[model samples]
Target: MILIADSGSTKTDWCVVGNSGKVLSISTQGINPLVQSENEVERVLRAELMPAMTYISDITDIRFYGAGCRDEMITVLERLLRKVFPAAVNVCVYSDLLAVARALCGKNEGIACILGTGANSCLYDGEHITANTPALGYILGDEGSGAVLGKLFVNALFKGRLSDKVRTAFEAETQLTMPVIINKVYRQPMPNRFLASLSLFIGRHIDEPDLHRLVVDNFRSFLVRNIRPYCRPDLPVNAIGSMAYHYRECLEEAARAEGMRIGTVMKSPMEGLVRYHSDI
Candidate 1:
């Protein structure tokens, strides 16, 4: 059996492939290394993964692609995974970005972008990443991400940039005043995630022209600041993430305006990973 995992900041997708290359089971959970500690990751894996592997014994291999599995953290993550799946003979851990590259480009060269709770981009040359644009977490960077969009919406509302009608509608929908919002941003932990959650509210008002403009502007900024730097101006780009998947049309329009040709947009990279490994 082969185990493949694709993990993001919010959740992870797990898939088990049998010897015949047939997927036996699929599961999901909150196991983001960026938000959860090593112990917490282990606990979730034990509860969610161990039981799922019961049908298959003598697992042969495991591959994990996760966010926050970088530098020293990779060693720590590999150790934790080894403890959980002791039956597996081989295990490989890599950054979630590699999964995106493998799943999106496979043996082909292209630019890959992840647009979700946070944003990241890389230039993949068939088998490996040749160049990357740093994703400086949700605070200073993540320009075109959910957190960034939420921050823009809130700032517009509080500063009277949004019209009275829009502001009234937003307040009515959220039932949150500017002061409460301020406290959440300044006093609470994971403020970026908190802000990103506001995208749900913005999503509700997507049909509104003003709101639509705001979304387009933010997404465009994301492409320009993060993706365009590593991607050649004429390069065709592939995207993977819930944000890019759900808003592909809008994102494509924004990218087109910037002279970028957009290709596939996928919400999950695990499916593609399964295919990539099957060929191997």
Candidate 2:
């Protein structure tokens, strides 16, 4: 059996494939090594994931791709997976960026990007990442992401950049005052998730000219700052994440404006990832 996991900060999607090609899908709360301690990760694996598996001994291979699974953090996740799946002979931990690259490009050369709660991009020559642009999280960077879009919408709303009608509607709909918003963003945990949640409101009001421009500009900035650095305009830019799938029209417009094109924009990488791993 093969077990594959795709984890974000908010959720983790798990897929188990048997030798007979039977598949079982499960969901669990996210396990990020950067934020969750070893005990927490172990608890999630044992408590949530183990319950979903019918035969743990059957899982001989485990492939985990997740946010914050880079550099030294990779070791942390690998140790936890090994502890959870002791019978597994092969356990591979990799960055979420690699998941997007493999899922979107699928052994072909292309620029792969992730635009979900956070933003990240890399140049992949089929098997490995050749270059990457640091996302720097939601505060300093993460352009074209849900968190950044929320940040921009809130800033414009409070700063009078948006019309009174929009502001009034937003305040009425969300019931969030500036003081409350500040408290959540500044003093709360997981501000990125909170900010990304506001994308729902943005999506509701996407037809608004100002809101449409805001989304387009955000994607344009991402292209200029993140994708342009790769210097490969001839190749199509592929993306995998909620933001890319939800606001594809705006993303495409931005790409066209920047003299580029979008290849594939998938809401999640699981479909392509499953295909990629199945062939192996």
Best lDDT among the predictions, by candidate number:
2
Candidate 2 Cα outliers beyond 4 Å, as residue runs: 19-22
- The candidate maximizing TM-score is 2
Give the TM-scores of the predictions, in the order they appear.
Answer: 0.91, 0.95
lDDT (Cα, tens digit) per residue for candidate 1, span 5-28: 887666678877776775666566
TM-score of 2: 0.95
Whole-structure CA lDDT of model 1: 0.81
- The predictions' CA RMSDs to the true structure, in order, are 2.1, 1.5
What TM-score does structure 1 among the candidates reach?
Answer: 0.91
Q: Tens-digit lDDT track for model 2 on 1-280? A: 8899999877999988776563898999997899989998999999999988987988899999998797999888888899889999999999899999999999889999999888999999988899999989888999999999999998998888998878888888999999999999999998888999989988999988989999999999999999999999999999988999999999999999999999999999987888778878
lDDT of each: 0.81, 0.91
Candidate 1 scores a C-alpha RMSD against the true structure in Å of: 2.1
